[model samples]
Target: MILTRFKKGDLFVAVVTATLLLAAGAAALIARAGAGDPVAIVIVDGAAVDIINLRDARAEERVYASALGTCAVAFEPGRVRIAAADCPDQVCVHTGWISRPGQSAVCVPGRVAVVVRGDRAEVDAIVG
Candidate 1:
């Protein structure tokens, strides 16, 4: 075995660092739990048309018709999806489902976007 030595303050620094890391993790989990629920905001043609609470929503589909095309949006508890759309690409439909805050599905051809928003204000990005 090889002999090694540690400075007196080394163990204290390590313990303090570990404690801070654990505290940060616990704070994050508490914040997420305190965030009541998430909601989906529907925007069409550059305007917000609807806001649906995913937590309280039941299984259902809502159809929206705009000058560009028609799109069908489906909602279930804690999630939402683009069930169908007249857009040629079908990208939105293929997106399947989104359940998390800040998630979104867009149908470019139809000019429709569904964005999920959390009850708590989240810092998505910070620009310098």
Candidate 2:
């Protein structure tokens, strides 16, 4: 039977298949971790209101119901965005997806700001 033959070609094929499987698994984990594994910190009027992990958040779309205003949020593999917002300007919604640490979406009218937190330095640095 072919199963009983331990040929060089067959051994190569088996090793390649196992390596590919491992690579795929690692990719999935990295996608879920996001770059730098930032945390989503919701700040209201300079106060931290909530904190959520961006990596684990992509399991499903969510809405950050705000008594101040309405903003629907969604999480994809390594990014998050305000899918919709009730703000008059729609600026927050238009801000689109944010994945990296220090990126943020602020809804001025809603008095809510979502910022990604991480260990990266110079998050607040201003450069030309």
Clashes of 2: 0
All candidates: CA RMSD (Å): 7.0, 12.0
> What ranges in model 2 sit over 4 Å off?
1-36, 121-128
In candidate 1 the C-alpha lDDT for residue 95 amounts to 90
- Per residue, candidate 2 scores C-alpha lDDT tens digits across 1-128 of 87787799989999999999999999987775544567787776667866777767755566665558877777767677778888899888889988787688889888777777775434653344
TM-score of structure candidate 2: 0.60
* lDDT at residue 112 of model 2 (Cα atoms): 71
Question: Which residue pairs clash within candidate 2?
Answer: none
Best by lDDT: 1
Question: Please, what are the lDDT tens digits per residue for candidate 1 over residues 21-116?
Answer: 999999988877846588889999989999988989899999988779899999999899999999999999999899877788999999999988
